[model samples]
Target: MAVQWHYPLMSNYPLESDTNNIAAYLYFFKVLHSRKEKVPDILDINDITTFTFFKSKSITHNHMSKWGLSDGMTAQLRENVPKYVQQINKS
Candidate 1:
């Protein structure tokens, strides 16, 4: 699947960390479903106890937009799963 990161959102957005992740993943599925994108029907979550799923550069951005998270929070999702980090990596 071709996951695009540069979504329409990310401008002065505001959201909590956990909420962002859930909403982002939800959004990811939404987009994929909308476009009829083919993906493995079975989603192998990292751990059943935790709602966290595997992170990927390809799926990150589009997913992040689903939640009302700010760009700052989105930046944090890269290295830190908390959703908000003080600084973003320039890399």
Candidate 2:
């Protein structure tokens, strides 16, 4: 899925580290689940619990405006099982 990391209400912007970026991604999902809003059916309990940060890319302010970043975002979904640090390199 095309997860939009450049979301507003993001407590931190230009995420300083990979760890922080990953945390932000996970946090986004947490907020989505908490809101109990209309979410893609693909996001089942197991998917939500197992969702992992696959990748992210920077976006421009103009793009953010066009898409209504503050309102929330919808993107392609990538699913993966949680893995240990050592196994991360392999996957």
Candidate 3:
């Protein structure tokens, strides 16, 4: 049997700015934790990053009143995780 898992953490907070999207993922965590007794294993907080949200085209659409992003800002974490993960897998 195959099991399906979803990594969609942005569904809760629609039209949220890139930096403001953390709460949405928090909502996902809350839901997953609600049934903590059933699923003993769940992804850890350090497992993923939500930076992809900023790269998305809908960045400015974070506001219904704003159809597009006029000004763009970028964020970079001090530690490069994905890069290291990829290199580790190449072995």
Give per-residue CA lDDT, model 2, range 27-64, as digits (tens). Answer: 43454453443232222321332234323234333343
CA deviation > 4 Å runs, candidate 2? 1-24, 33-58, 71-91
Instruction: Provide the clash count, candidate 2.
Output: 4
Tens digits of per-residue lDDT, candidate 1, 1-91, equal 3234323232112223433344344333342243232121112121212124435544565565444434544454344543222222221
Put the candidates in TM-score order, highest first: 1, 2, 3
Q: Model 3: residues >4 Å from true position, as ranges?
A: 1-23, 28-33, 37-41, 51-91
Q: Candidate 1 has which clashing residue pairs, if any?
A: 13-70, 24-63
| Alpha-carbon shift of residue 58 in model 2 (angstroms) | 6.3
lDDT of 3 by residue, 12-69 (tens): 3343434323333333334334342211121222222353443355533333123222
Residue 89 C-alpha lDDT in model 2: 50
lDDT of each: 0.34, 0.35, 0.31
Model 2 lowest lDDT segment of ten: 40-49
How many Å off is the CA of 16 in candidate 1? 20
